[model samples]
Target chain A: MSVPLLAPGDRVLVKDDWPEFRGPAHIRTPHYLRGKPGRVVRVLGGFANPEDLAFARPAPKRVLYHVVFERPPLWHEGEAGDDVLVEIFEHWLQPVPAERQAA
Target chain B: MSTPARPESLARLDRLVAALIAKGIVTESDLVEAQARTDRASPEVGARMVARAWLDPDWRRLLLGNGAEAAEHMGVSMAGAPPLGVLEDTATLHHLVVCTLCSCYPRAVLGYPPSWYKSFEYRSRAVRDPRGVLAEWGTTLAAGCRVRVVDSTADYRWMVLPMRPAGTEGWSEDQLAALVTRDVLVGVALPRLPVALAAE
Candidate 1:
């Protein structure tokens, strides 16, 4: 209902506890990127929250963010520094701390 | 695209089409036109744009910035389709397109969705481990290069404008386009040089 907290290019930490936080409910956030640190590549406007839409419930406009993660850090094995991208809902992300964001 | 789909699904589609026709919501001609439209939407359309972008700098800029406008200039029809997005691959940046939620593609420019693209394995992993997926397709980017994976959806559809390979100097647009396969358009593989294809 208010303005979105984060904008494009802000570093975000995806919350692992989503869609009931116990086991799993219908969700838009991918499983692998849970609790991972990544950077927002773009603010992809807003859409009906899929987290609620899955249950056929009314979903208000929610900001969508395109987040990018480096492969090696995100995964245990892979070439380092190659970026992986995903579109995640606003509720699924948290702003990283100021010091870590600066680094 | 020719891989056999389930017969029950095909029969269900036929029944749906029949219902539409009976209700006058659609006619046989409408189905025919839709079929023709999809048939015209092929990799060659994407390849043609890539070929022209290869030759013309301004055109490439226009193609990258606004794909629908560039497509109109090239006489490719994009009416009633979603906005187009062409992710340009450069020496430093590489791009891959996938619909992690569903199989959303630039079907107006790249024809029918490939079977592999719609597979659960690809939809599940492409966004999570793109470099590993690229490695599966024999594409390995350098350490410093950034691999951006774009998710195509209902609002925007994307295709890749792959970088031109070396050893093709003075080649005609057709020659360069000949090397641009559907996989290159999807960003799973690179356009092969003539020498590379010749060796195969």
Candidate 2:
């Protein structure tokens, strides 16, 4: 299998950017990090997305991006020790600072 | 072999036999022979392996480094099955195994997986909150042991060989194997038996 290309320090947003998928997937996203800001710290790897794999469709390659955020930044007035790091697919990410180009 | 069994029941039996054949546990040439052997064997082989590993350092290292090969030396072949990696528990690390998608097990090495190991409840909740699941299994870890939950996907399977208990200094391999249970091998149970308890 070909490795999906992704790198650390890349910024991302949810592909669907839905509130539900964000908060519920705790291993990737904590409830405090939902609707909060974060940045990619590690690029884990890539595989066929589970959604596509389940449907038996030929899924385009997707990279798994791990994001990091301070606990206080994610939660409004939350504790300091609750730092959050999450792994999400490449398609879910887009360039941060809107004007900066994603390469 | 025509009995008035219901179609569904017959289909279930066929599937069971097919699974057994695929695993090489049974063959057409010795169908009756295989059935008799399985009937005589305990359903807790996997558990026994776990317990034995916990008590033996050499065996634990062998299991963790090359599970299939080590199992083969013990007359178990983890062939035609997904690659299984056995994880050993230490003072700093603890391991838990779960099949996130489907129930894939190292049958040749550990024997049949328990019903709870393949349950939807265990599978779905394991990755989300492993400590909760471990708590249900009656295991409460000491401080500082990072719990690593391994997902057994289609490509890989995992078993946890826990650390040996403190009280058994002079025990035979057969005595050790008897303490190993299927749940312990699958990462759901811990091995805790004194020599006195083992003797009993």
Candidate 3:
């Protein structure tokens, strides 16, 4: 198993790029959550990449993390302090800069 | 004896099952038994877990820590499914579960996903306006309470552990379980003490 790149309590930003698959794409990350900033709640271990598995290909394991984002950023009329916790794979996450971690 | 013809709608499923059986991956009996198990699954299985958690703190810890194992302890088999996660509802925090991408549910505990849960309208509105959705379902939280919308997007499935309703202090596990419904486990509703029980 590959060591997880991120840990719980780490603030990360969801990658805004869409996965480029030739055919029969099975992307798990919701389009709405892309580019959102969230804090990692837990390391949910590794699993065979669904993007590859959906096509019946031999896939490598990818680390999955439970991340929590405040609802205000996720929805226009979202309540303050209300949160949305989403399970995001490691490839879709990037470390939030030190300057922005306090936000 | 000969096998009866299967429905045209089941052609794709029949072919897939035949292929798996041909490859020795699984037998016809295995599929039958699996279907039987799935048919037996219901919200009552999940509600029992909730009721047990309310009565036993240790079991509650187990339920929150490892939901699949907790289900197995309660005689519910979670074989061949993703891990289960139980979201606890506190006095200050409430959880609402949605699959914005598609219907990914804890089938072993709660059985099949409700049709409304898979609708595009619900999928789009749940995260965008959870409070509004809950209000439509007749669940209004206190002003200070916080809501958490859980998106079951990946390999881990989720269910809510709703706060146990009051006025049933000495109720049995069966009685407590009666208060929990499929909607309550999904976080759109809360367990309410029945009027007769409340007056007891």
Q: Top model by lDDT, which number?
A: 3
Which residue pairs of candidate 1 clash?
none
- Tell me chain A's TM-score in each of the predictions: 0.86, 0.61, 0.90
Specify the highest-TM-score model's number: 3
Docking class of 1: acceptable
**TM-score for every candidate vs. truth?**
0.79, 0.56, 0.90
The per-residue C-alpha lDDT of model 2 at residue B152 equals 53
Q: Residue B58 lDDT in model 3?
A: 97
DockQ of 2: 0.09
As a whole number from 0 to 100, the lDDT of residue B35 in candidate 2 is: 61
Flag the better candidate by DockQ, 1 or 2. 1
Model 1 alpha-carbon miss at residue A88, Å: 3.4
Taken over the whole model, the C-alpha lDDT of each candidate is: 0.80, 0.61, 0.90
| Predicted candidate 3 versus true structure: per-residue lDDT over A18-85, tens digit per residue | 76555457899998898998999999989899988999999999999999998767776777889899
Q: Model 1 chain B, poorest ten-residue lDDT window?
A: B147-156
lDDT (Cα, 0-100) at B55 in candidate 1 = 92
Q: Share of real interface contacts recovered by each model? A: 0.44, 0.00, 0.97
Q: Which ten residues in a row have the lowest lDDT in candidate 3 chain B?
A: B1-10
TM-score (C-alpha) between model 3 and the true structure: 0.90
Model 1 residue B134 lDDT?
A: 90
Taking the tens digit of each residue's C-alpha lDDT, what string does model 3 give over B82-199? 9999999999999999999888988999998878998888898888899999999999897889999998899999999999887878889999999999999999999988877668
